[model samples]
Target: MDARYAIEIDGLTKRYGSMTALDRVSFRVERGELFGLIGPDGAGKTTLFRLLTTLMNPDEGTAAVDGLDCVASYRQIRSRVGYMPGRFSLYADLSVEENLAFFAALFGVRVADNYDLIAPIYRQIEPFRTRRAGKLSGGMKQKLALCCALIHRPSVLFLDEPTTGVDAVSRSEFWDMLAELKAKEISILVSTPYMDEADRCDRIALINEGHLLAVDSPRGIVSAYGERIYTLSGGDMYALLLAARRLPHVRRCCPFGAAHHLSVDADFDAAACRRQLADEGFADVALQPAESGIEDVFIKLMNHE
Candidate 1:
């Protein structure tokens, strides 16, 4: 039990019958740090969250939350750690205020007891506090869930895919809320499938198929990318994608928005590529050097795995 760390896991392992969800996962989150688990769907982010929140026990390895062992101290961990599951688990028929009150009561605390703690977030939806959770829009529902999760003022918070189906603006606002929460010194462990959200955290762990591929500051991982990416765009995106795979000296090609992001070896010549595309009956072909981003890093790591 290390008090300095908010959450600590050593060789954590979990499996579902034949499938291994997490393998030898080890990491330590410093107090008040915002840590993100970035990966795609089915990448075992949810499984790791469950193990840490004491909802389920890991088959192997040891986990501690705020100096409490996840297994031996399951009861205490549940009381001290707030968990907002990936899915909306609140009572759909309950009004916004009701849901918050119910969750508070579950912990034997009253909503007014932590009103100051949740005021920043709860105020956003306070006007609609009487509306049933199921009838609220996606963004409003998200806010309600967050308020319920925070009512207890736990030392650590676990948010699983908090922005999953929300609109762009809502997503932005949700991240802003997380930033505010982090300021309050609540250690947060959040998981999301969006690679772009990696930048919001102080540090991140990139996971895929039960393997913890990399962990570092968002910039640190991008710096390790080691390869320069060329953004290519032309009239025909599909044709460009197909043609990109055939380019000489090119190691990786993935579609990024309207452009095809490509990584190539030293022998690859940009001028030659443009001429080659022109020869292949493609016109207005262009290629520009672009800095590698988190998406590129994840793709590179997955390929190596």
Candidate 2:
């Protein structure tokens, strides 16, 4: 229960009957730091968030928010944290203004009481105040959800996949809003399945299939991937992928955008790789050095496990 860390977790485990959702997972978020939990679907991100938000108790181990034990201080933690779940969970039938008002009242406060904190986000949806929550566009719905979550000015914010279904422009705008919130010194714990979103956070924890892979700054993770990587294109992608895997010292080959990112050991031969691809009826094969990204690191870690 360090004062500087907004949240602390240790050996937190969650299970659903025969299936385990999170296994001996642990991490910490410093006060006012924007931390990301990066993982794909069913990687146990949501389950862990639920444990920290006090929505559900972990089957084993402990979690604390703002130094309050999640199980014992559930009431206090709920009052001090704002949460936005992956799906839009607002009252769909209520008008935008009413929805905001209702959430503010639940915390025993009025919308105007914390207007400054949510002004930038709320103003965008003010014109649609009279419209039912269900009728708003995906982007507008996103803003409204965020507004309600912040109406009480919670010290910590937990957003679970806030931009999953929104358009690119809206996604960009949402991140910008997060930046503003961070400036106000609010510790944020955000989770996303999108690998590209990892760059937006100060630090990220990569998880897969109920296992914690690695935790580090996004740039640091990529830099730590010391293996040699190359991109192979200019041939039938499927055939190239199959042929590339057979090359000497080739460890992993996965399709990335227009090319297949091929990971290899130092003993791998670039010239021989090209020659073998051509000899296998795949001419015009182009192989060039490539930089490994967060996704690459994630894949490598998952494979090792």
Candidate 3:
């Protein structure tokens, strides 16, 4: 299939008083592509979503969703776009079936009209069709929300932090559902704080403090990390973390998986650091060549900024 652009954002900017939410942000998602906005909390991911979904106007710049302007064509965009906000906003008292029917009615459609689009996810929660939404599990709630959003057969889907606060098993299953949705030609834009999830996207934009750090395929981003990384674990974890930062050869050091990882100066001697740590009373010191991942690269980029 030809890769057509589904959503286009250019120089998008938004501010709340003196704080800028989105700073000249720009990116594009191809039709039927699973794109991800990877970053931590307060990185302007939600603000950007609101702009594309037409919930809020931008201070400057322009955004187009399915060839329709976000500001002037909001009604058209709303009809064609399915948005699942970061927080759960479904009616707590309504049954699963009722919630779906209510959303379908709002779009001038019937729950049965778009059954094919939502069946895969909705069926998993159908056993509890009459159960109140507030009483469902996290994974079930997410699945129901997704079903309601997609009941209109929207051309574009925007999911804001859909996996946050959910269990690991639920997160895995949620991504699997996204993969299945991609097969059906739905253009999906998902925002997440989990760096590990970035690898699942066709393209990822790393955002930090309202600035765009990098935008590329997962491999492309990792290939750009040219520094050597080392994991250190021994006595006085706190002291080791602090000492690594002060070392002349260590470019950057941050906590990772029960140990502090150091991105050292390319010219630094690994043996010398081992000897230094040994002298400082660190026992069973270990150092090895390690591969850099998205989170490592994100930390390095944040430190640079």
Write down the lDDT of every candidate, Cα atoms only.
0.91, 0.91, 0.89
User: Could you tell me the C-alpha RMSD of candidate 3 in Å?
Assistant: 2.1
lDDT of 1: 0.91
Question: By lDDT, who's the top model here?
Answer: 1
TM-score of 2: 0.96
Candidate 2 local distance difference test against the native: 0.91
For model 1, residues 1-305, the per-residue Cα lDDT tens digits are 79889999999999999999999999999999999999989899999999999989999999999999999999999999998898889999999989998999999999999888889888999999899999998788888888999999999999999988777788888999999999999999999888889999999999999999899999999897648789999899999999988989889898999899999888989999888989998899889988989998898899992
Measured against the true structure, the TM-scores of the candidates, in listed sequence, are 0.96, 0.96, 0.94
RMSD of 2: 1.4
Expressed as tens digits, the lDDT of each residue in 64-158 for candidate 3 is 99988899989899999999999998999999999999999999999888899899898899999999999998888999999999999999999
- Return the lDDT, model 2, position 269: 88
Give the per-residue lDDT digits (tens) of candidate 2, residues 163-218. 78667787777888998999999999999888888898999999998998888899
Q: What lDDT, from 0 to 1, does candidate 3 have? A: 0.89
After superposing candidate 1, which stretches have Cα over 4 Å from the reference? Answer: none
